[model samples]
Target: MHVLWRGDTLQRLRLVSGLILFTFAATHFINHSLGLISVDWMHEMQKWRWVVTRSWPGTIVLLAALLTHASLGLYKLAGRATLRLPRWELVQILLGISIPFLLLPHIINTRIAHVFFNVNDIYVYELAKLWPASAIIQSLLLVIVWVHGCMGIHFWMRLYPAYRRIFPLLLTLAVIIPLSALGGFAVAGSNVAAAIEIPSVFANLKVLTRWPDAAASESLAWLRNLARIEFGAVLAVIFGCIAWTYFARVAGPKVTVAYTSGPTVRVPQGPTLLEISRMSRVPHASVCGGRARCSTCRVRIERGSYGLPPPVFPEVVTLGSIGAPPNVRLACQIRPEHYLIVTRLLKSETAGPEDIAIEEADSAGVEKTLAVMFVDLRDFTRLSEKRLPFDVVYVLNEFFGVVGAAITEHGGWIDKFLGDGLLAVFGQRDGVEAGCRQALRTARDVDLALDHINAKLEAELGRPLAVGIGIDAGPLLVGRIGYGESVDFTVIGNPVNVASRLESLTKERDVQLIMSRGVVRMTGWIPPAALTDQVSVRGVAEPVGIIMVKRGRELPADVLALRAEEKEKEKPAAWTAGFWGRR
Candidate 1:
């Protein structure tokens, strides 16, 4: 039952129905193009239309499915009254509303013509004769129907993982198929006009009777008949069930959690802290949708630590990998059976409540400086394509885990993961000097961690991995962005970009670690004896002193062993340390 109600199932149904309709429309257009081949071919195709339309149970199912799909879409639009919808969705809604109206005349002129008039020979000749002057409107209607159907298919395909992987290919096909069919139709239309002989009187009459009014009236009559049937009642019932289920299942209940002071938040039961935070307008950043896949939502159970259940398999693995403290847990996986206060360590807009709470907390303040460290993988593009997709993801996750551990171990907070890099901000939440020192220490630790990781990779895959680290110190503006239902708390400033750029220059300088001059002046922490100099970076207009960070002899025996493995390989193991120096 749960499987049946799964969102993916409904999404699949929508996709399949859309594909069926798209195929039918494409084939129908190609058939219409038969006029280019010969009038006899077009007439023969018209004869088969009655046979196809009345085939055992196909017509009934086709009508039922189309009506059901349309109603479901309408219900979704009606439900989002309170939330702000994207502009693309609004355009899609408008297109959907126009489809039935534009399609009515075409449907009646052909289907009703055969049913009522028994005019089995109503092919492209009849259509061209009746509406020769309205070709532009007919063409526009065809394009609109095709575009709308394609949009529906695209929307449904986005829900599937496999489909997403091949989205570009699918998009290419969607474009090509329609254009090819249109080309075929244009050729057919030209041929039909050239071959058919039209009397002067008939040509004059065609222009006079080209208006869509009569066809529209016939369509309205068919719609009136449909509205009075048991089929309509069945459709209404099914639509109501789908709407109720979507609202109940997809939207769920609105839950809100409020944070007063400190890191703790009081939330209702049932929802995990991450869910409550997100749904309640709290600013929390969860890059991986609170699936315990990433530690972006880690929080400290400061007050009610005992009330929460122990971490599950995924939560336990992720927590252990990052070396989280006993009191710390992933907010996404922790579903407290009772109300509890949990201190959110990562201050994101989605995790924190209101701006007032943050302001008040600052007013009743604690100020400290912390170190900020940035580590970026070198030659990521080359590495990405060198391995399988899964391998690339695994290597990145492992790299981030090691880097994150080094930061936390040095008493620094990880601001965010910048794609193939790590951004760790040390001081503002703690203290200036402390932050600078921690940043240096983290850089040293990262050098050591990478040595270990690379040694393991070399032993496993016969190759080495390289990364660059940059440390900087400065003030930053941190706050939540978004309102009501969506919010994300993030740090922004020049220092962040400077730190990133410094990391970028590491590969060119043959250095693994670099620190800004501001860091050196502020912290008074010198690099290990083996490290080297100051170099000028672009944009700064002045030389910044940097160090060539290396694994120190004092590193743990296990770490030293890993370094020894690299040393034995006799590969180029030099790194430059400076503000900006080209090797």
Candidate 2:
């Protein structure tokens, strides 16, 4: 069989059809609102509405739009791999698909009654035939159609920059429009009820009903029966589609999609990555709910790209408009055929207790330019031997907090907690220059925090403690290394190893902080006073030049000073005679 429409064409057609339907509903509501003035005025306004919507051309548009919209909606619903969606999206779907079934009875009693029973398709005819029940039922149909149309508008306009600003005004209209129609409808029903008690009003209503007494009751019963059958059949088809969706999930081939945060979810091959996230109860952000209308559900593919299909036209247009990276694609559009690994591009969007805990993606072997800082306690081993094990643990915990605050305060993220030391990286969010500067500032502050910790301990144990800090900057691999839920996000490279050696050198050199010339150069800052020397680092034969920064010197660099309170902190001056003599 030949397909008549492409997905893109169908999408546009759905929009056109929905707009057509909304227009009809709006006019019908306006006619109902006229009942607030008088029932006769309501009928008069409806005559104009009938010309606009119930005439030959209008009827064609209305019927064609209804069939097209409902069919396309059901087709899309069946094609969706997973039904897990945001509450609003689910509500819109439920209400829209319910339109055919819910309005069947109203459709029969009016249009069918007029055809078979010779009743006028007007207010007085409705009063004579169905009376009170018709008003309430038609109002229910109006609400469902209005809400469904409003939801369509919301999904289309939410990504526009101005939508958020105008949301309140739009929401008020959404509520008031349907409510006014219902209120006016109730008033018209009351008028009809009052007319039943008055002879003149009843005489006027009798002219509208042309139902033949002999056939009227039989025709009305047949109409109600046909409506009930249509309603039941539509429900069965909808429920069957839902059942098929469930069975497809259960019986389809499954593929693994691994997240950088150590979650490996197995999902059926047909669903988009966003659908898999939803099916697995992973909170993925989809502001437009997988229709590719919003790019909130973007992901950066880390591995297995060869197994995925090329971007379709819709995905291409959306990604191009946003200027997304080549590796990044909307999760809602990507349907993977094989194993894959990915990281969420926008972690903040899925930030809630129910959402999957998203942290920094581990860059296994990917190289990055970063500044590494290593801080180690000089006398921790001897102190741990002297103190009780419980006390040692307590003291180490306290020390971790102090050093952690200092590193974090200077914009460095802790990479790992060593036995008596910690390794940190800077410039992950910024660049190498800023990272190097943050490492320098952190080294100084950690020295100060160490001093404070030592002062408190000195009063308790009559001995002060000391710490050594080393800073180095270079390209290194930064990512998760462990497996089976024991993953660790860390950095490893010559620079990291060199920094550790320098930290060890502080104990021998008896200085508070040691840094390589590489760190200083990376920071792009000229220092006032600093001790300089060549020290052999492990795994390297040639000695690397190092700079030992002293206390009370200013760091006069733009990269370091930007949004940081570390300008007055360090001054690196060349090591004069006997720089290590005091220690």
Q: Could you tell me the lDDT of residue 352 within candidate 2?
A: 21
Cα-based RMSD of candidate 2 = 12.6
Model 2 lDDT at residue 121:
70
- Evaluated against the true structure, the overall lDDT of model 1 is 0.57
Candidate 1 local lDDT, 367-475, one digit each (tens): 2233457788877767677678887888888888787776666555566667788777765423566567666666776777878888767665456777888777776
Error of 2 at 422 (Å): 22
**Global CA lDDT computed for model 2:** 0.71
Candidate 2 pairs with clashing backbones: 363-479, 527-572, 528-572, 528-573, 529-572, 529-573, 530-573, 553-570, 553-571, 554-570
Q: How close is every model to the real structure, measured as TM-score?
A: 0.41, 0.59
Question: 1-583, model 2: which lDDT tens digit per residue?
Answer: 0111112667868988988988878877877777777788888887787776767897788889988988888888767777778888899988986777667667776776676677777875665454575655676788888988998877766555456568889899888878887877777778778777788767766665664465776776677778678766876786788788778767988899998865799877888899889888876766656666555677878898888878887777766655566787889888888899987654434322111111223323457788898888777787778778888888888888887776666656677789988887777645677778778766666766767787777776557777788888888876546543244456789999899998888878777777888888776755444467888888977899887755412334453464543343233311211111111
| RMSD list, candidates in order | 18.8, 12.6
Global fold similarity of model 1 (TM-score):
0.41
